[model samples]
Target: MQKNHHFSYVIGAILILAPMLAQAETKDINQTKFSKQYAGWAATIEQTESEDMLATYPASVILWAGSTFSHQYNSPRGHKFAVADASHSLRTGVAIPPGGNGKSASCWTCKTPDAPRLIKEMGEEGFSGSNFVDLGPEIKSVIYCSDCHVDGTAKLALPRPHAQNAMAKIGLPFDEQNISMQGAQTCGQCHVTYYFQPENNNKVNMPWIFGNTADAIEKYYDTRRFYEWIHPISKTPMLKARHPDFEQWSRSKHADMNVTCITCHMPTVTDKNGNDYTDHKVSGALIHFDQVCAGCHKSKAQLTATLERNKAEVDAKSRQVQNLLVKAHYEAKAAWDGGATWPMMNEGIMGIRHAQWRWDFATASHGMYAHNPKEGLALLNKAIEQVSAARDVFKQVSSQVGAAKPVYPDISTKAKAQAAIGYDEPAAVKAKQAFIKEEIDKHWHPVATTGY
Candidate 1:
């Protein structure tokens, strides 16, 4: 009876180990030798194993892995190198001393992917959690092909996980399909201009809480007293123009009529051989007039003529708006100098902010003047009216106070004006030089060709 029981136990153990042993043997045989005698069989086995592994993994993971592999082996590094070099070179000229004024990690937001990674690596200790100001010249690349497209596919896609996460926070729903269609939304997150406030240090921000419109953003800025710089001659706090791609598009007829930045900028093209594909080589829409504009408009000559007319109208209107903005600043300066209190200056400041926002949004849109010429011209004209009206109000107030005519600063020459503003030129140059050296050193190391 004991012998029989032992025999049963041994048979059961063998049964359990049989599959495991077979797998081991198969792996060994497949990897053991490379000879022409077994070449065909080996190739078949290898392909089967690869397919099995792929099947085992999630589809998304497999797709991402393939993309990573392609970027490592096939993509050209020239653009990467050029972008890094240019960014580093530019940074060398804008270095500030340690703990200097106008220093913030927020400045690096659009410049490099390294800034966020470094922030994460440092955690609580690095930037005091609010230390977006301390990142120091790290970010330096524009959005690239890898940012939006998958490997081996021409489909434009979203690459940033943070954006999806952000949208999720706002209760914006997304599925794989809708997310895929909304590729421009991903690019818009950063491509849209923004200002980071020191008060809102912990969050990557946009000044759109008031809303996405020109008036709304301007109200937010005015309420917060946010100023990019103070004019050296006029001494009025100046708001610098940032690229307002999304905001401008939001108000455009294309946007109002449901067109998007991707519609015009990332339009599809057909090769001479009649192969149609989305042209991913992004630039201002004007570059591919025939392909982009003429595809929709049958008459290329008419579209060109229309664009030229729109450009002329926009230029004239922009100048008018800019002049009014300058005049408003001067008039406001006069009011303040003549003892205008905070309450008294509130309306004037609000007017300035609104006019500036409108002007900035209109001009910041590189293709707006042509995309819907009539709308663009109309918006610019409205912006001029707003600023001109505001200036007139300021002039009336200044006259009542018997204030002298306020001096307006000339910003036409970049260098002279930069120095006049007490910007630390020497420190900026030093920091930029150091950044270039660091970038050069990275090229010397054996670069890892794969993984994020």
Candidate 2:
């Protein structure tokens, strides 16, 4: 018993110091080293293009009411830019003031590597009480080793509470030994359609109570009477769809084939010395297509062409939904402006709500085109049907109003669109800059200099 106890003690000590010990030998490499090791693939990686899908649309359809911070509807880039992107985005940064940004410390939960430690120290309630600016100082590391690991082991763990809720809702039979599921579930920690439940508390919640489909998610939110914001002009309750990557990607061909996200996005590569390990620098599979696609597809050119074809088809359909949604919002606003009340246009309002929900589901699910193009296009068609019905309702209500035609505004750019929605872009930018300078820099700069 004494011998066994001493052996156990020695093993435990080594386990405790494993991360520190490993850092000396197998530390995460810098971008330069990474590029060299990755055969210059990292160098070709591009910053995610900045896009504002809403900027071109009318403010009535773009901006959410009662949100102090404005969100830019940009697609995510490589994980390397995680912190840089969040810190600069108006959605996360504008909410930095003591009570102004209209966001809680919970906002930082998925954005930082130190989330587990911060949550442990503050407790979930205390964390929610704090502001993004106050918590910004503590979150120095971007999404890194600590976010999903305990002492840098291959063993996976989930750090975010919302993911836990989602897994429970979906009735995912827990299996501690299933590392593949764990790896995939860990990705779900951030990559799903989620909303902050309470306005102030901001406890992350997935609309998975009903189901995971586009319609099912909308049904869940509708039953709960949840609305991210009411369209200021249209007067219809609206829900902003966040990235629904996991939901859309699940059960797709790749998923059905048991090709988890880690299998592609984090594919294992052999070093010059023939040591094999999964790459930790997560990015799009296409960025390192040779490494990922070469496992199955022989010709990279053919694979690239196939992906592009699917994406183009999906984008074309998504654009149709976007146009239809714009028309619906404007028509709905015209009806409201023409003195159409909820009592009179309840059915029409519901149509607009559900239609836009479908549109957002297809549009918001990152890489939905590649994951499941058929479903993506189908969702868009359903949205078109619903939005067309909404337009019909507006026509019916048009007889009661003075204006015969919907007054379309000249919202050609982001500024115009924001102005139409009563958004103060300058104010948001100023608040974000102030927060970064006064609060975020105190911690962000130090670690940034020392290097992530």
Candidate 3:
């Protein structure tokens, strides 16, 4: 009887809140568009495996580029954890209200379903300038059906403005794009590389004007003199490649063969009731080879062996490229400390910058080796070659200056690497906790709305 009464009370509370939740401007209270497959995946909060994922910046990253990655980085778990993880992540930082944490609102773009709604309510300018804390009250929903669904029709749409702009810049106007491309484009909306333009209140932007190729994107940044950061060790202008899955995949054989990201990651599945729907729980296709790949490759053993071989080869090349980068940074630092001027070293550092970009592009892409082995290997090889060229320049400058080789910093663990880069991880974590306890808890959840 008590349980029944509690249930009734909760239902009544929901009824009272329904009007507010279903306001004319934001009317998805029924959540009819939420995919069951996505819900199931979201519930699996322990699905934490990810390729090339690191809980913190690697030593190579610290010794070579001088990035602490905002003191935290972690493998993604599940859709359900996205908002919470982003909130607590040191990468996001403890954004104080009004001023925020120097990060843009675009950081929240992929983490919440409320983003699309917020974008609609606040114009692009308003959305771009909105503080993270300011958004806490409004954006309560995680990634959901409404984010990708077209109103009145359940068809998928790319609601992300930056992606649409990128597509348009590439002569592929999104609205006029074919229905067949919708799935990939929808995923690309968030999955592709983007940076917030500081000039425009850190508005979300992508460097797709020149093209999506590694070199082409590099060229675009070079032309604009845009850089994500400057390497503290190499003093080279640097651009960090975010997960560039769409850019790499678009150039892959699978894309040429008309394979969409959804085709693989969200393979169609049928239940015992004979209804067919695409699985919305997005992850790598390799995990569910039978569901996604068996139709193409009959022998699972052969397929697995082939994938493993490709992955091994790529992993080896990636490690080699990383080692070369570490060596190049150390050499450049030695030359610099020994009085190598910018006029003598800038060209070589630029080469290192471009090379590292390629290496990062290949390393960051999901299963690039297995997905597109040829391109993946080529990228790594190019990085190795570039590093070699940079090393030659470093040697020339060091020889001229008679500088001794710099000792590599000891950074065997994430903590040591962070310390090398001068990151206070504990302090950042504590600030996040304090923000959650005081600001977020006080403003985000109302006492009356707790039951609802």
Candidate 4:
């Protein structure tokens, strides 16, 4: 036992010292040597762009890098859902089956390295890759250096296994030339427009049915007669929008002008003495406007003013749309109360769903206005117009029956609104508390008191 204890201590000491020794040696190495090694690997990756070679990098490296990058870039502002943004954007959330028994496993694809391991362990009881819903509460940790670059080098590459498989099935080799396509090829798997379908048991799926644009997404929703949920008071169907960051961003001047997320969110850093390196500090462009935006805009004051103007415009337009939605909701509720049948509710439901979807698309997309003020404003303006039209239709219908003043529930507070809507708030709260306690217990040990 004593011999084993001494061996364990020696191993622990070596493990602790190993990284320090490596850093010391790395620091001693001249810039020329480091540059040569890094540049050579980068050039080779750039030349080959081999999917197989890119796949060799451990998935854990990509997961850690993605989590770290998002922590630096996306979550520093203390937004309400910053952690969810990081994890979901990284594709780390567990899949919940859409409706059945709530079994989920398929949603793990593109998110975790342990996915295959878990599936294998489950054997016949395991979930097929296509059987899960995307409704897990907390986001999973994923995305890392390995997702887009060769380990220890700065060259960009692809890590999506599903894309590669699709390409392979069609007899089109996943080639080096196609590696740089930014949307479907790179960001689409996580960042593009999406909606959750309850039919798939509230599984999240990209609405690529209409292509990746605000108009395209809106048109698809209109055509499909789809909705996320029916408003209890209004009796109108509604659609909840997720973050369409990449899609909304694509409409921006920067994208048309050829400015990529990698360009700004991942700007190059310069040392005090002038040595340049990629910042690798992901976060809002507002945090590092001088480093990221000023490089292109030339006038800092002008660009800052533009961003602020854009934010105000977006907020104002968003509220206008919200008011329209609220009005439509009340109109529909009045019709339902006045003995309107399913057919009478159809148009109102469609209007409500479309309007809410647009609102969600605009609001959920973080930094969209600042990134591309003109396009963001334009989209919101268009949505406002649509909702206004919908409201006019609702008003016309309700005018005949002399509708009552709308009872707009207070949705500003989730708990109050949920309880008012007849949901079991106490049960939900208790379940959430129990889940949190279980999670804490699973991950940590109880602390002992030191009082006399």
Candidate 1 residue lDDT tens string, 388-425:
77677677777877888887555443333333344454
What would the per-residue lDDT of candidate 3 be over residues 57-145, giving only the tens digit for each residue? 36454634445353665666666666766666666566565533556677788877677778888877688887765676666866666
Give the number of colliding residue pairs in candidate 3: 0
Using TM-score as the measure, which candidate wins? 3
lDDT of 2 by residue, 165-196 (tens): 68878887334427777788888788888887
Q: Candidate 1, overall lDDT? A: 0.51
RMSD for each of the candidates:
15.9, 8.5, 5.1, 11.4
Off by over 4 Å in 2: 1-71, 93-101, 173-177, 287-291, 294-298, 401-403, 442-452
Location of the lowest summed lDDT over 10 successive residues in candidate 1: 66-75
Clashing pairs in 3: none
In candidate 2, list every pair of residues with a backbone clash.
95-101
User: Where does candidate 3 stray beyond 4 Å?
Assistant: 1-30, 33-38, 41-52, 55-57, 63-70, 97-101, 445-452
Model 4, poorest ten-residue lDDT window? 443-452
Error of 4 at 284 (Å): 2.2
* lDDT (C-alpha, whole model) for all candidates: 0.51, 0.70, 0.74, 0.50
- What lDDT does model 2 reach? 0.70
TM-score of each: 0.63, 0.83, 0.86, 0.66
For residue 46, model 1's alpha carbon misses the true position, in angstroms, by 42
